[model samples]
Target: MNKKRLLAAAMSVLVAGSMLLAGCGQKDVKQAGSKPEGAAYKFRLAESNPAEHPVTLGDKKFAELVKERSNGRITIDVFSGAQLGEEKAVLEQVQLGAIEFTRVSASPLGEFNKQMSVFSLPYLFDSEEHMWKFLKGEMGEKMLNDLQPSRMKGLAYYTGGARSFYSVKPLTGIDSLKGLKIRVMQNKINMDMVAALGGSATPMPAGEIFSALQTGVIDGAENNYPTFVAQNHYQSAKHYILDAHQRIPEVLLISKVIWDKLSPEDQKLIKQAALDSVDYQRDIWAKTEKEAEAKVRDAGVTITEVKDLKPWQAAVKPVIDKYSADFKEALDGIDKARK
Candidate 1:
């Protein structure tokens, strides 16, 4: 072969090799960005309520938002009424990346992150406005960020409704609560608050509550009007006392593992959807409370709105002082929020 012809053949071979490598890189990129087949990204979202509850409404709305935003690239399977497990169990599943999402009351989260106890503090928030202000303010953002190290990402705060007292016997004043058995969330602050109010706190699961109330295992329980009515606790306990003591907020969370796997665009979509759903759920919650009150009233339950919370506040002040040391930052944040 001549020298010029040999050089031409070598150049042609190099060009062909370059084209093959470029083609492979393009194929890899396409594959990496492609959607999975058969199912969209399967996400298991669990909650601590039945499908008919407002919690389920929020879950369903979130799923619809994700599906719509992603054009059906993400599909969330919602397990309500503790089907996946209790709130604590589901939260652990989320931390381990075994579950994609969950809605939990901040009470149980206090065990994992003590800072969350701020939400458990009795009478910390003076009103619903104050509660929302603190939740959407800088303090709320800080509290939400506090979950990152625990491998959970907070999406939004849903209204759990104001905590109140209910009993088989009418509780007209703080004095009437003395020696009564009241079911509370398994949190130290809650136990202390019940004790301060002169009632014996019985920590139990929501699923076991109706049976407990029926069999006289517990004299009564405290929850929002909607919960008291929805759970049919009105049938077992005829008195609904509106103490409205602690306005505990329910937290919606996503697994950090799942969040990290998502594209930035997808993350933004999910976050926005969550925030929007909060507003929607809050509206539904208020209406639900009214309906619940009416329903229970019709069911022969006596509903009493406390004329003053000063006595109740005075009773639980010690609990605040005790838990305050561990939650100094949160207390400061709440104070700043008030200002």
Candidate 2:
């Protein structure tokens, strides 16, 4: 069999093993639902990235703050590297209260909250500064609060920086994208964005990206500097373009089912800790992203910077127009934030 099929079969077996383990540990995991009054509580936090990634660092920091603030009454174990499951499966577990918490990209979240898909729309944020402005204001809080209906609580937004196309093939500019099969998240807007840019979109889980690139199953993928380096996609995809197509934020979420069981005081404490962790995460994220770029360059990868986003932006205008009506409020808010 070819490498792509072999990798897929291996991952399938691993996922099955993880599910079997979860089944055996269901009783212990469900204990998170029953917190005794004024007693110690132990829970799990799922992260798909490696333990050393910035988001995982944020997850650990958040857990540390929670433990310290709770005076040892609350302790969280972080399961990184998809030890629990992939993003979608872990999200389902969180929704069912089987998993207490998870840190996931905003892309997969569109499945639960349609409003989330708005973030995946191309060029939605003029810059990272604009994104933070929207995320830290009323609109951001509203977006978080809106998650109650989905059985999840959005605590705070972690910086994911900008996502650009990286490929095994050299990407000179927008024209280089034509005929390339780029892997994208399973979000429709993301798929549409790639299609509008003249490439075929191959939707797959994040875990499958590295192998897909190595095996020629996909020619390119889009993501931020930290992710391209952290996930080691840079190793296989030697060309990086600074298109900054989308700046989707990663969210820290907890199961509302477990959250509702906590005392209001505890809830307040946890939320505050999560918010504080974002500040810590942002500091490291900036540094890590810079270092990531330098590291990849040292490895002899070609990093292309786009001089004019006007053409790229113009190309995806149809996609923007198609989704404009559906996300009028979000688009309007984003527009207002740019100033």
Q: Which candidate number has the best lDDT?
A: 2
> lDDT (CA) for every model shown?
0.81, 0.88
TM-score of each: 0.88, 0.89
> How accurate locally is residue 71 in candidate 1, as Cα lDDT from 0 to 100?
76
Residue 83, model 1: Cα distance from true site in angstroms: 0.9
Candidate 2 minimal-lDDT segment of 10 residues: 28-37
Model 1 lDDT tens row, 180-281: 998988888899999999999999988889999999899999998888877888998998888888888889899887677665666787888888888778
Per-residue lDDT value at 163 in model 1: 86
The sequence of per-residue lDDT tens digits that candidate 2 reaches over residues 1-339 is 457745654564455446534543655444534443353567789999999899899999999999999878678899999998888878877776777889999998998898988899999898889999999988888999999899999999999999999999999999999999999998999999999999999999999999999999999999988889889999999999999999999999998977887777778889999999998999999999999999999999999999999999999999999989998888888888888
